[model samples]
Target chain A: MDAAVTAAFDLRSWSAAHLDRVESALSRWVVAEAPAGLGDAMRYAVLDGGKRLRPLLVLAGAEAVGGNVQAALRAACAVELIHAYSLVHDDMPCMDNDVLRRGKPTVHVQFGQARALLAGDALQALAFELLAPDDEGIPAGVQARLVRLLARAAGHEGMAGGQAIDLASVGLALTEDQLRHMHRLKTGALLQGSVLMGAACGSADAQAQDALRRYGAAVGLAFQVVDDILDVIADSATLGKTAGKDAQQDKPTYVSLLGLDRSRAYAGELLAQALDALAASGLRDTRALDALARMVVDRDN
Target chain B: MDAAVTAAFDLRSWSAAHLDRVESALSRWVVAEAPAGLGDAMRYAVLDGGKRLRPLLVLAGAEAVGGNVQAALRAACAVELIHAYSLVHDDMPCMDNDVLRRGKPTVHVQFGQARALLAGDALQALAFELLAPDDEGIPAGVQARLVRLLARAAGHEGMAGGQAIDLASVGLALTEDQLRHMHRLKTGALLQGSVLMGAACGSADAQAQDALRRYGAAVGLAFQVVDDILDVIADSATLGKTAGKDAQQDKPTYVSLLGLDRSRAYAGELLAQALDALAASGLRDTRALDALARMVVDRDN
Candidate 1:
């Protein structure tokens, strides 16, 4: 096969292969220290569902930087665990009060609300546990960096902070900038963090790191824009959860602020920005990232 | 002063001084990243209240181990954050449904269930964030170990695991062993983790670490036993919250299972065990740890 032919990335196969690794690791690690039936709740929340996008972003970032494979794997799972926990808590009666997620009952619905809350809390701790592996597969420096990156993204300044803003923003008119800021913290930080954690797993030049940051930012925003679009146009079945939840809840979103067509167009623009930043990275290969970026924009759900 | 005379450690002075340091650090770090009023809820939950036992345990353990001061400070704050978050969640309507904590309205009562949930989640992340400081005040190895100890103690098979069992055993008649197991995970794990994290901050040989572990376990279980005893004998004013609430809920407790006198004796016995472990550690100075163990057994609240 020609170099150009080999260079062409097939995201389906890539995703399939990586998802298997993530699924297996999640299964093994999620139960490593769970007591009694709590492991069952955690496994239910983590395994056999979701797109596993964050883990893929982590792996792709690691590949771009030729990062440590063990650290990359752990970071990948850690991010997904964070994402899963957020979703679990968000679906609780006290939060979003949702019943469906990833075409199944939300954690709170499957397990009781209290169990769900405990599961979410345990999952958050389990994430850092994964990063700080006892066997020392990765260096301690990388472990600290991974924990720092993850904690920042998941904590008050990042996802939780964004959710706070979002929760308070309900029924209120939020400007494009404000909405962007909210999403930047809520979703963007972790997405960017996944990339940075991957980079931290190994060596990445300052310039390359900057490029990856921009790529992650663009891809992250593109994801939200696409999500907003899907919430408006895609059916509940296709979206895997109730469609139009934001509109139903009167939450401000890209579609709510910019209309569906503009949101779709904006997602494309962001996708272009992501690819441009990836190109600036000057890595040996970033086709996986590019394909992911495009997929984020073009996916119907 | 003679060495023997100085060896008579005063816990009151030690706690007062360390509490000032812990409180100030917590105030600075808790708000460092909070968005909107989420920080307000977090600060409210963390500051100006509670016994601050966990932080004291960490500091004392560090002092005994001659550990890195900076890392010890961070670990102290991190473990407390986990403890605070757990309380916030535990007091929510979906869990224990308590309306009071430390004589104030529960977090969910004051901030609403949704914000309370987010605040607790943020605090947990903040715990990890504190451990993984960007300035590198602590070595990466120490940081990893600190995170591992805290995460293991806070996650399943630890605090959350114990809570799950406690939640499930609401009306059940649990044996003494079963009740001990529950409290060990629910409350003992983080308490024990405080000591281990402190030890991890610098240097402790296997023998010393083992001794510290034993001391932590004894103090941890002693704390719960004292708590149960207090719930039976102390008033809401003295206990800083409702008393006799355990019997009200019919949940298994040391007092409920073992009777008040035996439970009190058990706490005293555990305190003795903790002191014995310190003696076995063979460290030059373990007076602070000794003081803390005594405090855990004897504190009115």
Candidate 2:
């Protein structure tokens, strides 16, 4: 194929194939075995879910570094579990209080509040458990690295910290920088951690690691920017979550601060930066990473 | 001193000294560095008070095996963090809904519900982060093993699952076997995991490991049996929590299943089994373990 033709390579087939693997891995790992209702709630939160963007990022990063597929698969599923648990907790009455998510009732809405709380807690533990399985296929060093990255990304300094900021910032005007910082920790940390974890699966030289980190940062910010835009532009049916939630909650967002037009332009700039980092990565096969960046910027939801 | 005099060594000084170390490690590790309210909430949930039995068990287990003190300290604090987070979440309005814990307002009662929820979530993540720090003082293999042990003990098949069963069986009558199974997973698993995690910090032969596991299981269940007895007999002020909560919530307990006398006897039996296993381990310096096992059964609160 010509260069232009290859540049326009179809991501649909790639996503479909990888999504199948991600779903199967998630299903096998997230079992409804014990604790009866709690396991069911965990499975409900994680399985048959929203877009598997974090897992895709992980797999794509692994491919870029020629990493181990088994480790990448585990990393991918682990990140998704963290994401799913966050969503479950965030939608509780004490938090965002949303009734709908991914076109279905939230875990709390479906399972009641206490069960939802336990389910989220269990899911978080399961993520770490999956990362550090007793199996010999994944090296102890890799397991340790993955746990370190994921734990930091999910902990007080990362996603949970961001959520706290978001909670405290409700009805308060935030500067563009403050908003960016909040999103960077809340959503950006885990997204970046996913890329690093994927890279950790095998080996990446310093240059490649640095480039991947840059790509991850750009893509992570772009994701939140686009999400803010989608909350404004898309309907709840299309978004698979309550639309315009930020505005309704009086929470500051990208569109709220930068305006819709500027937010769109900012996402475009981030997409370009992400692609630039990929180009500098000195890796031959980062097509998927490039494609995922575009998808993040262009997706309606 | 005579052997009898040495055997009757005071546990207070020993516990006091080790508790000082555990507190310092926790204070150093669980910082209020960023995200504003989150650090405060996490600190509030973890610091100040609790029996710190899990951390003591970890230290004692490590000492018995001639394990690394640094690794054991980290594991000790990590288990305590998990225990603290679980209590924070369990005390929320949606769960047990108690307002008092450790002689003060619960996390949700002091911090708002949302912040309390986030704090608990962040604390759980922090537990894993402590287990897998970037420092090289703890080996990668040990880190992986610790993460695996903690995760399983805390996840659905263990602590969370036990909570689920407890929630579901609130009004239902449970058989002695069923109740034993529930307590084994809920409280017993993490206590057992603490001993195992401490042992993982150093070398333990198969025979020693098996004996420690048995000892851990016995002490873990005995702790709960004694807890149930205390709930019936102790006052809230003495317990530092709302006493008789299990009965108030109409939850089943050992005292309810077997009469108070039989329940007390069962606790004694379990304590005896724990000491027997420790003796079989062929480890000379298990003075702390022996003392801790006795403390679990004899403590008033």
TM per candidate comes to 0.98, 0.97
Candidate 1 residue pairs that clash:
none
Per-residue lDDT, model 1, residue B181, is: 90
Instruction: Kindly list the per-residue Cα lDDT of model 2 for residues B1-301, writing each as its tens digit.
Output: 2364356657799889999999998988889885868888888898989999999999988988888888899999999999999999999999999999999999998989999999999999999999888875788899999999999999998999999999999988999999999999899999999999989999899988999999999999999999999999999999999998999899999999998999999999999999999889977577888899999999999
**Model 1, position B73: C-alpha lDDT score:** 93
**Candidate 2: deviation at residue B128, Å?**
0.4
Chain A vs. true chain A, TM-score per model, equals 0.97, 0.97
Reference-based lDDT, residue A44, model 1 = 93
Candidate 2: segments with Cα more than 4 A from true spot: A1-8, B1-8
lDDT of 1 at B251: 87
Candidate 2 — which pairs collide?
none
Q: List model 1 lDDT by residue over A83-173, tens digit each.
A: 9999999999888999999899998888899999999999999999999987956899999999999999999999999999999999999
**Residue B154 displacement in candidate 1 (angstroms):** 0.2
